[model samples]
Target: MPFDMIGGRTFYAYNSHFKNIMLKCFRKLSTSSSLMDKRYIPRRAVLYVPGSDERKLKKIPSLSADCIVMDCEDGVALSKKEDARSTIHQILQSQAIDFSGKDCSVRFNSVDSGLCEDDMKEILSASHLPATVHLPKVESPQQLEWFAGKMKDILKNSNLSEKLRLIIFTESASSLLDLPAICRRGVELSKDSPFKLDGIVFGSDDYCADIGATRTNEAKELSFARQYVVTVAKAFKLQAIDIVYINYKDLDGLKVQSEEGAGMGFTGKQVIHPGQVPVVQAAFSPRPEKVEWAADLVKAFEEHQRAGKGAFTFRGHMIDMPLLLQARNILQMASHS
Candidate 1:
């Protein structure tokens, strides 16, 4: 009741205060910064642009990353949330930033923050809707339920395909514990609504602080959480985004982490700086040799299937349904990349 009351007041203030998330720009009003619809939009570099920074906001048009996230959560100071919200809303509503061919998004504060409702309410009431919205600090499937219910209500008049894509951050112990249920709920929502649950992003810094763990050079401490997020994502066929490499200047270090995350089956790695974009994108992309191998194996698997065979051998190795699925994922990444 309190949450709804706050949002109710916020929605009125927004439009009256003069309203507006990563809004994928659609073709109807498509300018040089419009986005394309693809079932497999690569999120190899999920770049977070602070909503409060005018300089960074302007630089968005030039960035080549797969996804652009205008942050309203941890990236912005508490005092600046209102201003950040206004700025991002205007940018989306007026097409102030050029998001051409980009999967641009906006990140709201957590439901627990008491700021998410206002953030979401203002933006959802805008003339233009974001293609995606990022929700951080999720702790349960119930939180997702609350979020989805609001999304469906706020954008009831917009086109479903272009409404919004939701990617959540699992930053707490409780969230990780309930990861399966949370992601499963997301899948269930997608099945019933046009507002799709796009991906799951692992928030390492917040998770560590929540658990009182020390940050390390190797990042071995997060091994379980990282891999677990990816495993659950794959089980439901959702996009799995790896955590960001905090050291923006250390390109080499970032590359190593990006590759490690990719090897663990993460579809992408979050990046804090523009310099890290290329390395992350390259690291997540399927290697040419691996793509070829997958293509050939898939061909063999199909042929074997047609010939009434189940288990098959390809390139001197035993192959099964699991391996075949792996091949398909590689090809999917390659094609999209």
Candidate 2:
């Protein structure tokens, strides 16, 4: 029998055939509405709080952001990495840090940073784990496979029924080039693996730095990277989180950029400041007109389906499976909002 190590402890693993059967059962149960609520939870505004900042951690329960990310990566200074890890671990283990109605995630350092191992060790050892771990600077599918293996070991060792999820941060030129492969691997692993890959986050600052591109208010330099991230994420049925708008003080500029990102198919935006959260959320939400149109399309499609028609005309456009799916998604998002 094979054995897996987690936090220095080893355990015997199930045989391949037994594991496959269990996975099929789990997938069936996962499709239930209650267990699948996470799929519809709107992540329009994912606010990043420095792990070293106790005040911000304490404020998480009261924040209105759709997702709160306790960051151990670029948000924390190099000298305070250990301190940040300790602080975040304490917060995760605390009962007062209630993330009941909101999504919670922790951003770990890059796999090659040498700091990620210690970060993972502390996180997996915690009595309470975040819903997801956001990995920065992912350049290949092998990196995701390595992390997934560790997560499986940890969850199995802890006897935790909740699956630990992952969000990949595409922060370098290499990651951009490997986007399709990375997304494919994530989707393939999610079917039978304990580690569920939920989303892809575009990190513009690091990406621009890596490519020697100038950062600007226009954001023309990042257009291609942003589109690629969103397109691949949608292709894999994963949420696409756009880069943070660094100008927290410029609410107007943030609004403009948020709207622009929404237009480009991004499902959410990273928020550096609490003030940016509401703007980002509002930007990604379906407008009144959009919601109305989606409802109409859904009704029309159902009527056509009842009449034994596969495709029908609506507003000078053909209504088919893809268009119907898009309409249903809008209504679903509106309900969550």
Candidate 3:
């Protein structure tokens, strides 16, 4: 038998036919030369905190989230937008919030909101700039192009054009439909441009409202949209972050949803509450058994390659370049996590 029993469940130890299929699929995906760099930057749990809340801002240094997003968008009240921007600028400038080696980003309002320009201006003017800028409600490639153009001027003036990265949030059906094009623009911007497109985030709350669809605990309503985001992100080699789990009180539900998101190919999840951070991070991290298997596969593949073999058999399965790549990715993720 090619399967092995582990923890009372059957695991596919080897399957030559399945390996061949995966090899073909990966080869097709790799053909896209425009694919962005797939660096494993531990973005498993991205926590959002309202920028206007000084109490919350003060507490950020103690949190263990892989990425902290100081939100100036939907998280802030309309009347408090200016205050939030000012507060965020102060927090960044003070350098009082210790990132603890975590990535920091600021989510500005949408381009159409008429407040994004001011938000960018204030945030960019800070002495301690965020590593990334998150753009919400991205609907078209043109909007990204416009923002990129504007950011060029800001970053040029600040001398940080090459340092600041960008991650866009898709919150509407229109954005979902134009995902591929948006991702293409992202790739284009990263090349000889000031701002690099690091990833794409899905905002299910806004998307559900935009589509007039009711959200349920089962989450069947978001399957197609979520899968589309993951597919486009993988095609472009960008990170795909899943929607936030609003039910922060339900830890079990959060874990279940996080596992589902990870299974669906999302590299990370967004969280509103601090308690959800560890759960999401654990869910997206590589399993110990999988990491061990990946290491073994790499070792065997290397030995075979040293013998001048392009493809070889491993535990009753075919080991090829695609499979090698998969093993390497798994190892990389495990090491970073």
Q: Can you rank all candidates by lDDT, best first?
A: 3, 2, 1
The local distance difference test score of each candidate is: 0.77, 0.79, 0.80
Q: Write the per-residue lDDT of candidate 1 for residues 184-271, one digit (tens) a residue.
A: 8888987666577878999999899989998875799999999899988888777899987887888778878988998899999888
Give candidate 2's TM-score: 0.80
The Cα error of candidate 3 at residue 30, in Å, is 21
Alpha carbon lDDT of residue 135, candidate 1?
A: 91
Which numbered prediction scores highest in lDDT against the true structure? 3
Clashing pairs in 2: none
Assess the local accuracy of residue 243 in candidate 3 as a C-alpha lDDT between 0 and 100.
89
TM-score of each: 0.78, 0.80, 0.80
Candidate 3: the clashing residue pairs are none
Off by over 4 Å in 2: 1-38, 159-162, 293-329
Local error of candidate 3 at residue 124 (angstroms): 1.5
RMSD of 2: 13.3
Worst 10-residue stretch by lDDT in candidate 2?
A: 3-12
